[model samples]
Target: VAFAGVMFHLMIGSVYAWSVFTNPIAKQNGWAESSVALAFSIAIFFLGMSAAFMGKVVEKIGPRLTGTIASFLYGTGTIMTGWAIHQNSIWLLYLSYGVIGGLGLGAGYVTPVSTIIKWFPDKRGLATGLAIMGFGFAAMLTGPVAQQLMASVGLEQTFYLLGTFYFVIMLLAAQFIVRPNLALSSITENSISQKKGTRLTRGPELTANQALKTKSFTFLWIM
Candidate 1:
Protein backbone atom coordinates (compact mmCIF):
# COMPACT_ATOMS: atom_id res chain seq x y z
CA VAL A 1 0.00 0.00 0.00
CA ALA A 2 2.81 2.40 0.86
CA PHE A 3 4.60 1.62 -2.40
CA ALA A 4 1.38 2.13 -4.34
CA GLY A 5 0.80 5.43 -2.57
CA VAL A 6 4.32 6.49 -3.52
CA MET A 7 3.67 5.66 -7.16
CA PHE A 8 0.38 7.56 -7.04
CA HIS A 9 2.12 10.58 -5.54
CA LEU A 10 4.83 10.48 -8.18
CA MET A 11 2.22 10.60 -10.93
CA ILE A 12 0.23 13.48 -9.41
CA GLY A 13 3.29 15.48 -8.48
CA SER A 14 3.47 16.60 -12.10
CA VAL A 15 1.60 19.70 -10.93
CA TYR A 16 5.02 21.06 -9.94
CA ALA A 17 6.06 20.82 -13.58
CA TRP A 18 3.51 23.46 -14.61
CA SER A 19 6.32 25.93 -15.20
CA VAL A 20 7.60 23.79 -18.05
CA PHE A 21 4.42 24.56 -19.93
CA THR A 22 4.23 28.27 -19.06
CA ASN A 23 6.50 29.61 -21.80
CA PRO A 24 5.22 27.32 -24.51
CA ILE A 25 1.62 28.15 -23.66
CA ALA A 26 2.37 31.86 -23.48
CA LYS A 27 4.16 31.89 -26.83
CA GLN A 28 1.41 29.92 -28.50
CA ASN A 29 -1.34 32.23 -27.29
CA GLY A 30 0.61 35.52 -27.39
CA TRP A 31 -0.49 36.12 -23.82
CA ALA A 32 1.48 37.83 -21.05
CA GLU A 33 3.47 35.45 -18.90
CA SER A 34 1.88 36.81 -15.74
CA SER A 35 -1.56 36.18 -17.14
CA VAL A 36 -0.62 32.63 -18.04
CA ALA A 37 1.05 32.13 -14.69
CA LEU A 38 -2.22 32.95 -12.94
CA ALA A 39 -3.45 29.49 -13.92
CA PHE A 40 -0.77 27.89 -11.78
CA SER A 41 -1.71 30.17 -8.90
CA ILE A 42 -5.36 29.28 -9.26
CA ALA A 43 -4.54 25.60 -9.48
CA ILE A 44 -2.57 25.86 -6.22
CA PHE A 45 -5.26 27.86 -4.48
CA PHE A 46 -7.90 25.27 -5.34
CA LEU A 47 -5.49 22.48 -4.57
CA GLY A 48 -5.26 23.66 -0.95
CA MET A 49 -8.97 24.43 -0.62
CA SER A 50 -10.17 21.22 -2.25
CA ALA A 51 -7.75 19.11 -0.21
CA ALA A 52 -9.27 20.36 3.01
CA PHE A 53 -12.57 18.73 2.02
CA MET A 54 -11.19 15.72 0.13
CA GLY A 55 -9.36 14.46 3.24
CA LYS A 56 -12.70 13.89 4.89
CA VAL A 57 -14.04 12.40 1.67
CA VAL A 58 -11.20 9.89 1.66
CA GLU A 59 -11.97 8.99 5.27
CA LYS A 60 -15.53 8.12 4.31
CA ILE A 61 -15.02 6.51 0.89
CA GLY A 62 -11.52 5.04 1.29
CA PRO A 63 -8.42 5.89 -0.72
CA ARG A 64 -9.14 3.52 -3.60
CA LEU A 65 -12.38 5.22 -4.60
CA THR A 66 -10.96 8.68 -4.04
CA GLY A 67 -7.80 7.85 -5.94
CA THR A 68 -9.73 6.38 -8.86
CA ILE A 69 -11.87 9.50 -9.05
CA ALA A 70 -8.72 11.58 -8.89
CA SER A 71 -7.25 9.71 -11.85
CA PHE A 72 -10.29 10.43 -13.97
CA LEU A 73 -10.56 14.09 -12.98
CA TYR A 74 -6.87 14.80 -13.44
CA GLY A 75 -6.62 12.90 -16.70
CA THR A 76 -9.72 14.43 -18.24
CA GLY A 77 -8.67 17.86 -16.99
CA THR A 78 -5.27 17.54 -18.65
CA ILE A 79 -6.85 16.59 -21.96
CA MET A 80 -9.18 19.54 -21.53
CA THR A 81 -6.14 21.74 -20.95
CA GLY A 82 -4.92 20.80 -24.40
CA TRP A 83 -8.28 21.70 -25.85
CA ALA A 84 -8.31 24.96 -23.90
CA ILE A 85 -5.00 25.95 -25.43
CA HIS A 86 -5.99 24.80 -28.87
CA GLN A 87 -9.04 27.03 -28.63
CA ASN A 88 -6.96 29.95 -27.30
CA SER A 89 -9.36 30.50 -24.41
CA ILE A 90 -7.66 31.50 -21.18
CA TRP A 91 -10.86 31.17 -19.18
CA LEU A 92 -11.22 27.57 -20.33
CA LEU A 93 -7.59 26.99 -19.42
CA TYR A 94 -8.23 28.19 -15.91
CA LEU A 95 -11.33 26.05 -15.58
CA SER A 96 -9.63 22.92 -16.88
CA TYR A 97 -6.20 23.10 -15.26
CA GLY A 98 -7.02 25.24 -12.25
CA VAL A 99 -10.44 23.96 -11.17
CA ILE A 100 -10.73 20.41 -12.50
CA GLY A 101 -7.11 19.42 -12.30
CA GLY A 102 -6.72 21.07 -8.92
CA LEU A 103 -9.61 19.01 -7.54
CA GLY A 104 -7.83 15.84 -8.70
CA LEU A 105 -4.56 17.02 -7.17
CA GLY A 106 -6.24 17.57 -3.82
CA ALA A 107 -7.84 14.12 -3.75
CA GLY A 108 -4.73 12.26 -4.95
CA TYR A 109 -2.40 14.19 -2.62
CA VAL A 110 -4.38 13.57 0.57
CA THR A 111 -5.50 9.96 -0.13
CA PRO A 112 -2.04 8.42 0.30
CA VAL A 113 -1.06 10.54 3.28
CA SER A 114 -4.16 9.72 5.29
CA THR A 115 -4.47 6.07 4.17
CA ILE A 116 -0.81 5.20 4.83
CA ILE A 117 -1.09 6.46 8.40
CA LYS A 118 -4.03 4.11 8.96
CA TRP A 119 -2.05 1.19 7.51
CA PHE A 120 0.90 1.80 9.83
CA PRO A 121 -0.70 2.96 13.03
CA ASP A 122 2.38 2.07 15.08
CA LYS A 123 4.71 4.10 12.87
CA ARG A 124 2.37 6.81 11.56
CA GLY A 125 5.05 9.45 11.18
CA LEU A 126 7.25 7.15 9.15
CA ALA A 127 4.36 6.00 6.99
CA THR A 128 3.24 9.56 6.26
CA GLY A 129 6.79 10.68 5.51
CA LEU A 130 7.40 7.73 3.22
CA ALA A 131 4.21 8.32 1.24
CA ILE A 132 4.76 12.06 0.96
CA MET A 133 8.41 11.63 0.02
CA GLY A 134 7.42 10.72 -3.53
CA PHE A 135 5.38 13.92 -3.74
CA GLY A 136 8.39 15.97 -2.68
CA PHE A 137 10.63 14.19 -5.20
CA ALA A 138 8.11 14.26 -8.07
CA ALA A 139 9.27 17.48 -9.72
CA MET A 140 12.82 16.23 -10.18
CA LEU A 141 11.46 13.18 -11.99
CA THR A 142 8.67 14.85 -14.00
CA GLY A 143 10.37 18.10 -15.09
CA PRO A 144 12.92 16.75 -17.53
CA VAL A 145 10.45 14.27 -18.99
CA ALA A 146 7.85 16.99 -19.56
CA GLN A 147 10.47 19.21 -21.17
CA GLN A 148 11.50 16.44 -23.55
CA LEU A 149 7.89 15.61 -24.44
CA MET A 150 7.21 19.23 -25.34
CA ALA A 151 10.35 19.36 -27.45
CA SER A 152 9.48 16.24 -29.39
CA VAL A 153 5.72 16.53 -29.77
CA GLY A 154 4.90 20.21 -29.24
CA LEU A 155 2.76 21.71 -26.46
CA GLU A 156 -0.80 20.34 -26.61
CA GLN A 157 0.28 16.83 -27.51
CA THR A 158 2.41 16.66 -24.38
CA PHE A 159 -0.65 17.24 -22.23
CA TYR A 160 -2.56 14.52 -24.05
CA LEU A 161 0.23 11.99 -23.70
CA LEU A 162 0.95 12.81 -20.09
CA GLY A 163 -2.74 12.82 -19.15
CA THR A 164 -3.20 9.34 -20.60
CA PHE A 165 -0.05 8.06 -18.94
CA TYR A 166 -0.97 9.51 -15.54
CA PHE A 167 -4.48 8.07 -15.75
CA VAL A 168 -3.20 4.53 -16.27
CA ILE A 169 -0.46 4.71 -13.65
CA MET A 170 -2.65 6.31 -10.99
CA LEU A 171 -5.48 3.83 -11.62
CA LEU A 172 -3.15 0.84 -11.21
CA ALA A 173 -1.55 2.35 -8.11
CA ALA A 174 -4.96 3.02 -6.56
CA GLN A 175 -5.83 -0.66 -6.78
CA PHE A 176 -3.23 -1.52 -4.13
CA ILE A 177 -4.22 1.25 -1.70
CA VAL A 178 -6.73 -0.79 0.27
CA ARG A 179 -7.56 -0.55 3.93
CA PRO A 180 -6.24 -3.48 5.94
CA ASN A 181 -8.81 -5.91 7.38
CA LEU A 182 -9.72 -6.35 11.05
CA ALA A 183 -7.67 -9.55 11.45
CA LEU A 184 -4.44 -7.83 10.44
CA SER A 185 -5.37 -4.72 12.36
CA SER A 186 -5.94 -6.73 15.52
CA ILE A 187 -2.50 -8.33 15.21
CA THR A 188 -0.85 -4.91 14.92
CA GLU A 189 -2.94 -3.64 17.79
CA ASN A 190 -1.87 -6.60 19.93
CA SER A 191 1.80 -5.86 19.22
CA ILE A 192 1.35 -2.23 20.11
CA SER A 193 -0.55 -3.17 23.27
CA GLN A 194 2.26 -5.52 24.34
CA LYS A 195 4.90 -2.85 23.78
CA LYS A 196 3.01 -0.05 25.54
CA GLY A 197 2.18 -2.27 28.54
CA THR A 198 -0.88 -4.58 28.61
CA ARG A 199 -3.20 -1.93 29.96
CA LEU A 200 -3.65 1.38 28.07
CA THR A 201 -4.47 4.75 29.57
CA ARG A 202 -6.96 7.06 27.95
CA GLY A 203 -6.89 10.83 27.95
CA PRO A 204 -9.94 12.80 29.00
CA GLU A 205 -12.25 13.45 26.09
CA LEU A 206 -12.94 17.09 25.33
CA THR A 207 -15.71 18.78 23.44
CA ALA A 208 -14.99 21.69 21.11
CA ASN A 209 -15.76 24.26 23.79
CA GLN A 210 -13.60 22.51 26.38
CA ALA A 211 -10.80 21.82 23.92
CA LEU A 212 -10.55 25.52 23.07
CA LYS A 213 -9.30 26.26 26.59
CA THR A 214 -6.64 23.53 26.71
CA LYS A 215 -2.89 24.34 26.52
CA SER A 216 -2.50 21.85 23.69
CA PHE A 217 -5.14 23.70 21.70
CA THR A 218 -3.39 26.99 22.37
CA PHE A 219 -0.08 25.58 21.15
CA LEU A 220 -1.74 24.10 18.10
CA TRP A 221 -3.41 27.38 17.29
CA ILE A 222 -0.14 29.22 17.63
CA MET A 223 1.59 26.78 15.37
Candidate 2:
Protein backbone atom coordinates (compact mmCIF):
# COMPACT_ATOMS: atom_id res chain seq x y z
CA VAL A 1 0.00 0.00 0.00
CA ALA A 2 2.81 2.38 0.93
CA PHE A 3 4.67 1.70 -2.29
CA ALA A 4 1.50 2.16 -4.28
CA GLY A 5 0.86 5.44 -2.50
CA VAL A 6 4.34 6.65 -3.42
CA MET A 7 3.82 5.69 -7.06
CA PHE A 8 0.49 7.56 -7.20
CA HIS A 9 2.03 10.66 -5.67
CA LEU A 10 4.93 10.65 -8.13
CA MET A 11 2.55 11.06 -11.09
CA ILE A 12 0.27 13.67 -9.50
CA GLY A 13 3.25 15.70 -8.40
CA SER A 14 4.01 16.40 -12.06
CA VAL A 15 1.98 19.53 -11.41
CA TYR A 16 5.16 20.98 -10.00
CA ALA A 17 6.63 20.82 -13.47
CA TRP A 18 4.07 23.26 -14.85
CA SER A 19 6.76 25.91 -15.01
CA VAL A 20 8.58 23.90 -17.63
CA PHE A 21 5.64 24.25 -19.99
CA THR A 22 5.11 27.95 -19.42
CA ASN A 23 7.74 29.33 -21.77
CA PRO A 24 6.98 26.86 -24.52
CA ILE A 25 3.25 27.52 -24.34
CA ALA A 26 3.65 31.26 -24.19
CA LYS A 27 6.06 31.30 -27.11
CA GLN A 28 3.90 29.06 -29.24
CA ASN A 29 0.63 30.89 -28.59
CA GLY A 30 1.95 34.47 -28.53
CA TRP A 31 0.41 34.76 -25.08
CA ALA A 32 1.52 37.23 -22.44
CA GLU A 33 3.56 35.52 -19.76
CA SER A 34 1.07 36.38 -17.00
CA SER A 35 -1.82 34.95 -19.02
CA VAL A 36 -0.02 31.68 -19.51
CA ALA A 37 1.05 31.65 -15.85
CA LEU A 38 -2.58 31.95 -14.71
CA ALA A 39 -3.27 28.34 -15.70
CA PHE A 40 -0.76 27.07 -13.18
CA SER A 41 -2.01 29.42 -10.49
CA ILE A 42 -5.61 28.40 -11.13
CA ALA A 43 -4.71 24.73 -10.89
CA ILE A 44 -2.91 25.32 -7.60
CA PHE A 45 -5.83 27.29 -6.17
CA PHE A 46 -8.28 24.55 -7.10
CA LEU A 47 -5.93 21.91 -5.75
CA GLY A 48 -6.05 23.49 -2.28
CA MET A 49 -9.77 24.24 -2.33
CA SER A 50 -10.72 20.75 -3.49
CA ALA A 51 -8.52 19.01 -0.92
CA ALA A 52 -10.50 20.52 1.95
CA PHE A 53 -13.68 18.77 0.81
CA MET A 54 -12.20 15.67 -0.86
CA GLY A 55 -11.05 14.23 2.47
CA LYS A 56 -14.67 13.57 3.37
CA VAL A 57 -15.25 12.01 -0.06
CA VAL A 58 -12.28 9.71 0.46
CA GLU A 59 -13.57 8.69 3.87
CA LYS A 60 -16.90 7.77 2.30
CA ILE A 61 -15.73 6.03 -0.89
CA GLY A 62 -12.32 4.56 0.07
CA PRO A 63 -8.89 5.37 -1.41
CA ARG A 64 -8.90 2.93 -4.31
CA LEU A 65 -12.00 4.40 -5.91
CA THR A 66 -10.90 7.93 -5.11
CA GLY A 67 -7.53 7.28 -6.74
CA THR A 68 -9.11 5.71 -9.81
CA ILE A 69 -11.37 8.70 -10.27
CA ALA A 70 -8.46 11.00 -9.75
CA SER A 71 -6.47 9.24 -12.44
CA PHE A 72 -9.33 9.53 -14.89
CA LEU A 73 -9.92 13.22 -14.29
CA TYR A 74 -6.23 14.09 -14.29
CA GLY A 75 -5.43 12.01 -17.34
CA THR A 76 -8.36 13.38 -19.28
CA GLY A 77 -7.45 16.89 -18.24
CA THR A 78 -3.93 16.47 -19.56
CA ILE A 79 -5.17 15.12 -22.87
CA MET A 80 -7.65 17.97 -23.11
CA THR A 81 -4.86 20.46 -22.57
CA GLY A 82 -3.28 19.17 -25.76
CA TRP A 83 -6.51 19.77 -27.62
CA ALA A 84 -6.83 23.20 -26.01
CA ILE A 85 -3.35 24.09 -27.20
CA HIS A 86 -3.99 22.82 -30.69
CA GLN A 87 -7.19 24.88 -30.88
CA ASN A 88 -5.50 27.97 -29.34
CA SER A 89 -8.05 28.24 -26.58
CA ILE A 90 -6.65 29.41 -23.24
CA TRP A 91 -9.97 29.18 -21.42
CA LEU A 92 -10.24 25.53 -22.32
CA LEU A 93 -6.77 24.97 -20.90
CA TYR A 94 -7.93 26.53 -17.64
CA LEU A 95 -11.04 24.36 -17.58
CA SER A 96 -9.16 21.18 -18.37
CA TYR A 97 -5.76 21.56 -16.64
CA GLY A 98 -6.92 23.92 -13.90
CA VAL A 99 -10.36 22.83 -12.72
CA ILE A 100 -10.47 19.15 -13.66
CA GLY A 101 -6.79 18.39 -13.21
CA GLY A 102 -6.62 20.29 -9.95
CA LEU A 103 -9.50 18.32 -8.50
CA GLY A 104 -7.65 15.11 -9.29
CA LEU A 105 -4.45 16.49 -7.79
CA GLY A 106 -6.25 17.26 -4.55
CA ALA A 107 -7.89 13.84 -4.26
CA GLY A 108 -4.75 11.97 -5.29
CA TYR A 109 -2.57 13.94 -2.88
CA VAL A 110 -4.75 13.34 0.18
CA THR A 111 -5.91 9.70 -0.26
CA PRO A 112 -2.49 8.09 -0.09
CA VAL A 113 -1.20 10.10 2.85
CA SER A 114 -4.28 9.30 4.89
CA THR A 115 -4.30 5.59 3.94
CA ILE A 116 -0.56 5.10 4.51
CA ILE A 117 -0.78 6.60 7.99
CA LYS A 118 -3.36 4.01 8.97
CA TRP A 119 -1.19 1.21 7.63
CA PHE A 120 1.89 2.40 9.57
CA PRO A 121 0.45 3.61 12.87
CA ASP A 122 3.64 2.63 14.67
CA LYS A 123 5.69 4.87 12.36
CA ARG A 124 3.11 7.29 11.02
CA GLY A 125 5.53 10.21 10.91
CA LEU A 126 7.92 8.16 8.79
CA ALA A 127 5.16 6.88 6.57
CA THR A 128 3.80 10.37 5.86
CA GLY A 129 7.28 11.79 5.27
CA LEU A 130 8.18 9.10 2.76
CA ALA A 131 4.85 9.37 0.98
CA ILE A 132 5.04 13.15 0.61
CA MET A 133 8.66 12.98 -0.42
CA GLY A 134 7.51 11.44 -3.68
CA PHE A 135 5.88 14.77 -4.57
CA GLY A 136 9.16 16.64 -4.16
CA PHE A 137 11.14 14.02 -6.05
CA ALA A 138 8.70 14.15 -8.97
CA ALA A 139 9.80 17.69 -9.79
CA MET A 140 13.37 16.47 -10.13
CA LEU A 141 12.74 14.11 -13.04
CA THR A 142 9.63 15.56 -14.68
CA GLY A 143 11.27 18.87 -15.63
CA PRO A 144 13.96 17.17 -17.70
CA VAL A 145 11.66 14.50 -19.07
CA ALA A 146 9.04 17.07 -20.07
CA GLN A 147 11.71 19.21 -21.66
CA GLN A 148 12.90 16.30 -23.77
CA LEU A 149 9.39 15.30 -24.73
CA MET A 150 8.47 18.83 -25.71
CA ALA A 151 11.57 19.06 -27.88
CA SER A 152 11.00 15.69 -29.50
CA VAL A 153 7.23 15.63 -29.97
CA GLY A 154 6.16 19.27 -29.56
CA LEU A 155 4.13 20.59 -26.61
CA GLU A 156 0.72 19.18 -27.55
CA GLN A 157 2.01 15.69 -28.18
CA THR A 158 3.98 15.85 -24.94
CA PHE A 159 0.76 16.42 -23.03
CA TYR A 160 -0.93 13.55 -24.84
CA LEU A 161 1.83 11.05 -24.10
CA LEU A 162 2.40 12.10 -20.53
CA GLY A 163 -1.32 11.99 -19.83
CA THR A 164 -1.52 8.43 -21.08
CA PHE A 165 1.49 7.43 -18.99
CA TYR A 166 0.09 8.95 -15.80
CA PHE A 167 -3.31 7.37 -16.34
CA VAL A 168 -1.92 3.86 -16.64
CA ILE A 169 0.55 4.15 -13.77
CA MET A 170 -1.90 5.72 -11.30
CA LEU A 171 -4.68 3.31 -12.25
CA LEU A 172 -2.45 0.31 -11.67
CA ALA A 173 -1.13 1.68 -8.41
CA ALA A 174 -4.65 2.44 -7.18
CA GLN A 175 -5.68 -1.19 -7.59
CA PHE A 176 -3.07 -2.25 -5.03
CA ILE A 177 -3.91 0.41 -2.46
CA VAL A 178 -6.35 -0.38 0.35
CA ARG A 179 -7.11 1.19 3.66
CA PRO A 180 -5.73 -0.72 6.62
CA ASN A 181 -8.23 -2.08 9.12
CA LEU A 182 -7.26 -0.04 12.09
CA ALA A 183 -9.92 -1.67 14.28
CA LEU A 184 -8.76 -5.25 13.68
CA SER A 185 -8.39 -7.16 16.98
CA SER A 186 -4.88 -8.37 16.22
CA ILE A 187 -3.68 -4.85 15.44
CA THR A 188 -5.05 -3.42 18.68
CA GLU A 189 -3.59 -6.24 20.75
CA ASN A 190 -0.14 -5.98 19.15
CA SER A 191 -0.01 -2.16 19.29
CA ILE A 192 -0.90 -1.96 22.98
CA SER A 193 2.67 -2.71 24.06
CA GLN A 194 4.80 -1.81 21.04
CA LYS A 195 6.15 1.52 22.22
CA LYS A 196 7.16 0.76 25.78
CA GLY A 197 9.13 3.87 26.78
CA THR A 198 7.08 6.54 25.04
CA ARG A 199 4.50 8.55 26.94
CA LEU A 200 1.51 7.36 24.94
CA THR A 201 -1.96 8.75 25.54
CA ARG A 202 -5.38 8.19 24.02
CA GLY A 203 -8.25 10.63 23.92
CA PRO A 204 -11.66 11.05 22.38
CA GLU A 205 -11.52 11.43 18.62
CA LEU A 206 -13.10 14.71 17.55
CA THR A 207 -15.63 15.18 14.80
CA ALA A 208 -15.25 18.17 12.46
CA ASN A 209 -17.81 20.20 14.39
CA GLN A 210 -16.27 19.32 17.72
CA ALA A 211 -12.77 20.06 16.50
CA LEU A 212 -13.83 23.51 15.25
CA LYS A 213 -15.12 24.35 18.69
CA THR A 214 -11.69 23.92 20.27
CA LYS A 215 -9.12 26.64 20.93
CA SER A 216 -6.38 24.60 19.26
CA PHE A 217 -8.29 24.50 16.01
CA THR A 218 -8.93 28.24 16.11
CA PHE A 219 -5.29 28.99 16.89
CA LEU A 220 -4.03 26.70 14.18
CA TRP A 221 -6.39 28.31 11.70
CA ILE A 222 -5.09 31.74 12.65
CA MET A 223 -1.49 30.60 12.34
List candidate 2 segments past 4 Å from native.
Answer: 182-189, 192-200, 213-215
lDDT of 2: 0.89
Tell me the spans in candidate 1 whose CA falls farther than 4 Å from its real position.
198-223
- The lowest-lDDT stretch of 10 consecutive residues in candidate 2 is 185-194
Which residue pairs clash in candidate 2?
none
Q: CA lDDT of 44 in candidate 1?
A: 84
Residue-wise C-alpha lDDT for candidate 2, range 39-96, written one tens digit per residue: 8888889889988998898889999999999999889889899999999999999999
Give the alpha-carbon lDDT of every model: 0.89, 0.89
TM-score of candidate 1 on Cα atoms, chains taken together:
0.91
Count: clashes, candidate 2 = 0
